[model samples]
Target: MTVDVRLITESEYPDWLRAVHTGFLQPPVASDEEARSRRPYTDLARTRGAFEDGRCVATFRSFAQQITVVGGAALPADAITNVTVTPTHRRRGLLSRMMAADLAAAKERGDALATLIAAEYPIYGRYGFGPAAGVAEWTVDVPRTGLDRRWSRPESGRIDLVDGANVRKLGPDLHDRFRAVQPGAVGRDERWWATRTGAEQLPDHPWTEPFYAVYRSPAGEIDGLLVYTADDKWGDAKQPLNTATVLSLIAVSPAAERALWHYLCSVDWITTVKTGRRGPDDLLPLLLPDPRAARITLQADFLWVRLLDVVRALEARTYEAAGTLVLDVRDADGLSAGRYRLDATPAGATCAPTTESPDVTLDVRELGALYLGDASAVRLAALDRITEETTGAVARTEALFRTAVRPWCPDVF
Candidate 1:
């Protein structure tokens, strides 16, 4: 049987949605009204569906976005999401065809990069996607007092607890302000905010009505906000011990971040607090009296970024130390293929083709690894994947390409 690939039309939305929910095992399929609400932001033209005998078997959606790089420049990018294939259609190469078609479309649209939070990691690596960000989950016993002494009494900042539903509106503003100065942070559009907060006039998830707390500095400027929910007696109580969990917490500024942590730790009647999906370099240690009370679990996988245009992707981000390096990138799939010289300084980077002075040669996947700061040039060279001709070119390239902080994405797409 041959599978047909085509754009999903408005009339076919019900079938498409049904296939998606069943394929992904999403509980309780979304209603027609809910689907209608999501239609505006979704690009139906970019949504592809594979069908066998007039039945939808696979589907995916792609949307264009303006992603702000670590340094500050905005680049045209594509976010591939909502990819799912029916069980009956699995291992039939439907996904590969869909992805290839979508990527080709994105390339034709002039997208320089593609990003997504993979539902499964292994499936994406073959597509040239590399893990570009990570989230660290932490647990702490509130009574341990490790956080007590280090926790400075927060200065006067106006904090207002608002309805969680209102978070959809306020989150974008807070995120926009936060990403402006933060390196390796991506921008969130309305659709992204709506999906995260479950507020796009869609069928909502009852378990996820998170509370929003907005923080204003003494100067009366809104600097930070947190979306969180408290879970009481969350763990096994049979052992004579119980715990509380802080489901989510996002702070936009350093002061606001500290204040939010203080508030969470001080919540009464909670023996322990569990916070999942936070920055790898979260400031809890600095604010805690005993840093030992904060137990951090280092877990990988967050956002996967694929460079569609090497020059644009390389030049978009800021460099730490200054240096010039040549990159010989091999793309097995022929998506990103080129040899270019990246001249990077503290200011930014300028990438162009070079006929001489080759410093490093690596594959596109390795380049993706380097771009995310997950694998350094020296490490790749030692692994025999990156070839370095000069004495300290590896070190120089690593230093020049290092991000301001370890790349982390607290939000799962």
Candidate 2:
């Protein structure tokens, strides 16, 4: 059967939405309200669909984004999301076609890189994407945290239970401050806050009214925000056994993080707290008196990145020490393949194409993994994913690329 893969028109949006839901194993129906709610934010030019026999069988979309690199430099990124392929359309190269088109356009538009939250582990590597960051979720046994039962207020800041309206008003600016210092972080749009705060609602996925709490410093400045929901549970004898699950938590300061966590563990009848996805090396576990009280519930790769412009991506972030290296980046798709010389110093960095002998050779996907500074070149070399042509090149790469703290992308998208 012949399939047509191209950008969807504005008139085909409802059908596209249905295709998306169907591909994702949702209700397989898109209501008019759902289309209308999402249409304003949808860019038709960047949204593509694979149609066969007048039915959309696959869907893909990308949007403008800014990703924070090492040293807090935000680079232009093409953030891919809402990608789905119906089971019937699998193994037909539908995704490859859509990805090639989108990436070509992104490179033409001068986007430094492309990013996505991989739903599966083994799919995107063939498309020049690599796991760039990891996420961790902890389930804390509150009673074992060894905190005082009478603990209510923090020593430095105070936590206030605010409403969603207040979060919509204060969230954007606070997130900006937090993202500025966070590597691997991505910028959020206005619609993100609106939908998250329930200013606008989605039909297919209904929004629950979650409790919003904001942490204020002693000087009266908002520095942290926490959203959580509690489940009501009881034993056979009517003993309370509740779990407070954090939906989202953003803090710009360590004090704010400590205070919010302390407040959660101290809530009456709250026997457990599920800390949401956090940085792999997050302070959540260490904040507790007994670090072992916070049990690891989930640890997995979260963010994947694909480099489009090797020079721009390599030069956008800072290095740990002064060094020069010739890197031979191999890209099977030839989107970002070249031998480049990178001269990095304490002040800045410069990368450009060169004919010099390579000190190290690797694929563009591996470079994407190393770009955020969380990945270790030595480990990749040990795994045979990287080839060190010169003596001690792998160690040099490790010293230059690894950050003190692991890179974490807080938002899934």
Candidate 3:
């Protein structure tokens, strides 16, 4: 069957919404509610659908975003989302066609990279996206874990609970401040904030009725925030064991991080505090007297990055060490496939296409995994995803690509 692919029109948004939600196996949203929910941030110009027999069979969209790189630079990225195709449309080239079109458009518009939080690990690598970072899930036995007394408390910050409605007013500014310093964070527009705070004007949105809190400095400045929800469980022995699950937590400083974790553990009737999508190097372990009380229960890929322009993406971020390497990048899409020379110093980096022999040969996906400095070149080389053509080249590249902070993407979208 022939399928037509084109940009979705404004009049067809509800149908677009239903098509995507249905394809994902989610309950359909009420048309009236969706219409009432304003989505200026949705950018219909970037939304597309695959139509067969006058009905949408597949959907895709990419929002403009600023993704933080090493050294605190926010580079342009196309945040791909709402990717779905009906079950009947599976095995067709719909996914490939949509991804190629979206990526090509993003590249043509001068985006440095494209990013997504992959729902399934194996599907995106073929499209040249690599798992650039990993997040660790923590299940903290709160009762067994005591706050580290030796840890100096925040000088001026105080943690205070706030209502979900208050999050609408405070979350955006606090998040902006937090994102400025955190590598791998993506900018969240107003629409995203509205959705998180349940202020998006949509009725019965998914997620718990969020309990929000903020860490405020003595100077009355918000330094950190946590959004979470809890479910109370009763045991056969008549015990109240409630679980507090952290949906999102952003702390600007180490002090704030410690304070927020402590506060979460201290919540009344909470037997366990769980959080995920936090960087592997999260500080909760360091914040507790018994570090073992907080166990890493799960760890896996989080942010997947795809470089749209090899030279631009490589040159955009700050480097830590001085080195020169030639990379022969292979891309199935042929968008960023070529040999390029990268000269990186602690000061900055410069990259351009080169005709010289390559010191390393790898796929563009591996190159993207190395982009944020979370994936080590040596590791990828050992995994056979990357090749070091010369002796010590892997070591040299690894040293140069190391980031000061382990990159983590806290933002879901």
Candidate 4:
């Protein structure tokens, strides 16, 4: 029997979701409540499935999103997720077909790029995606931090424990303020907040109530929010050996960040704190009095980007310095291929197809890496991933593309 790939009907969602779970090695089940909860947020036309013998065997979906670029401009993105193929149907071109259709639709829709969090590093590159941002995690030994255990309140702000309702009320506005200035950050929708705060729970995923802490500046403005859970353990002699794990921490200011870390370190009975995935160069370690007290647990690439429109993607970001260069962007899929001239300035940039000779020649995947100002063109050139057609073009590319602070995407998509 031949397999068919096409956009799934609303009636086929459950089968599609079950196929997703099966591909991910999870229980292949979707409850009615779960289906109801997800349907409202899903755009059915963008959800495609591969069917064999009247059953879904592969799944892929994309949604509307906005990602902040180098100078804090949010570009419309086609955010992909829930991609999978059954083991029985491996290497059958299902993923490629689904991806091609989606990318074509995205280009027609005028999205600047497509974004995803690659579960495996090697999978997305062949699809023209590249690692754009990285994440870091650390485990802190509270006893070695050398902080006052008797610390009570923040020096310049106050920390207050609030409930999920309060977080739902304040988080969206605060996140808007944070993502506006933070490169590589993506927008979060109402469903994300609702699911995180227990407004709606998906089936087969257990939820634990976490403690929420909000930091207010001296003027009483909310600038930070911390969500954490604790494991209760006791030593043989009745000493507390609890460890607090941070689920999410959002801070808009340095003072708010410092105050939250201070509060976590001083909490009674909490001997260890696990900082969840953060930006590779997060301030958590430096915030501690003894920086060595925090040991890195994870350092890996997090967000992956694939440029759909080369010209628009280049013009969407602001350059760090003034320079003009031509890029020979090679896309094997023939979606976004051509030599383009980019005239960049600190103020803004303009990119368009031109007949000018190339100064730097690179694949579209490499441009995705450089788009958010995270990856260095000079380093990629050294790796032979990029060619500098003109002397000093790589340096100019490096200077124009690199941001003072590395790009960091807090959400996984």
In model 2, the clashing pairs are none
Ranked by lDDT, the better of candidates 1 and 4 is 4
Off by over 4 Å in 4: none
Candidate 4 minimal-lDDT segment of 10 residues: 198-207
**Tens digit per residue, CA lDDT, model 2, 1-413:** 79999999988899999988888788898989889888988899899999999889999999999999988889999999999999988999999999999999999999999999999999999989989999999999998998875899999979999998899889999999999888989998888998888888887667889999899999999999999999999989988899999999989999999999998888888999999999999999889889999999999999999999999988888988889989999999999999999998756799999999999999999998998888999999999999999999999998888888788998976
lDDT tens digits by residue: candidate 4, 1-413: 89999999989998988898899898888777778877888899999999999999999999999999988789999999999999999899999999999999999999999999999998889889999999999999999999898999999879999998999999999999989888989999888898888877776667888999999999999999999999999999999999999999989999999899999999999999999989888998998889999999999999999999989888989999999999999998888999999999988999999999999999999999998889999899999999999999999999999988888998876
lDDT of 2 at 31: 87
Poorest lDDT segment (10 consecutive residues) of candidate 1:
233-242
lDDT of 4 at 161: 98
Candidate 1 Cα misplacement greater than 4 A, ranges: 27-30, 148-153, 164-170, 191-201, 234-248, 389-391
TM-score of each: 0.89, 0.98, 0.92, 0.98
lDDT agreement with native, every candidate: 0.74, 0.92, 0.85, 0.92
Query: For each candidate, C-alpha RMSD in Å?
Result: 3.2, 1.1, 2.6, 1.1
On a 0 to 100 scale, what is the lDDT of residue 409 in model 2? 92
Candidate 2 or 1, higher TM-score: 2
1-413 per-residue lDDT for model 3 (tens digits): 69988888887777778888887788855465665564555788889999898788888999888998887789999999999988888889898988988998999999999999999999999999999988898998877887642433455678788987778788888888877777788888777787777765455455557788888877778888888889979778988689999999998887778788877787777788888568888888877889898989999899999999888888878788999999999998899999999999877899999999989999999988989989988889989998888888888889888786888888787
Error of 1 at 399 (Å): 1.3
Q: After superposition, how far is residue 260 of candidate 2 from its true place, in Å?
A: 0.6
